[model samples]
Target: ISVWTTLAALLGGMLAADVVLGVTPAYFFAALPRAVAISNLWLALGKSMVFGLSIALIGCHYGLRVKPNTESLGQGTTASVVTAITVVLLVDAVFAVVFKNVGL
Candidate 1:
């Protein structure tokens, strides 16, 4: 949950920056319209939320299955970390592909 929250906050900051950069009249008029910029910001936020929630839920599920033994706890922690990282990377790649194809 902490990881997801952090990721979501980071993504929100990125989207905010993108919106600022996109709204400069120079670029706004030179490239896509303002509505498109706003839409993109919303879309990015939505994607980030979805990815964050997915990783958080997966982590929680795996974490809840851990045994009380130290070894089991350690292993569960490791697995959760790996799963979260993998999911983050996979979602990033998917976003990259989608954005590239969409000409964003």
Candidate 2:
């Protein structure tokens, strides 16, 4: 699951950067060193877990509140996907902001 999650995040980030930032995959690869230098692995891991928990909690709440139906199940899955993407972006953004601010 961890490997799959990481792969998914890598793909999503690459796509987002390409589409939104006008950065090619090659440029992203070149910029990886800067990303690594700035990111706090431990903090990012903790934040990622927190984000996962929040998503789980939200899904659970919705699951309990809504009727057990195909639509509800689909909604839960969509929520999970959105949560995962949001967490990945949030972590990257935090890393970038901190790196810039601290001159990393």
Candidate 1 residues lying further than 4 Å off, grouped into runs, are 1-36, 101-104
lDDT of each: 0.72, 0.70
Pairs that collide in candidate 2 are none
lDDT of 2 by residue, 1-104 (tens): 44466668877998999999999999887886678653444455556676667667766765676657888788877776687678667866876676554424
Model 1, residue 25: C-alpha shift (Å): 13
The lDDT leader among the candidates is 1
TM-score of each: 0.59, 0.40
Name the weakest run of 10 consecutive residues (lDDT summed) in model 1: 26-35
lDDT of 1: 0.72
Q: Judged by lDDT against the true structure, how good is candidate 2?
A: 0.70
Off by over 4 Å in 2: 1-39, 99-103
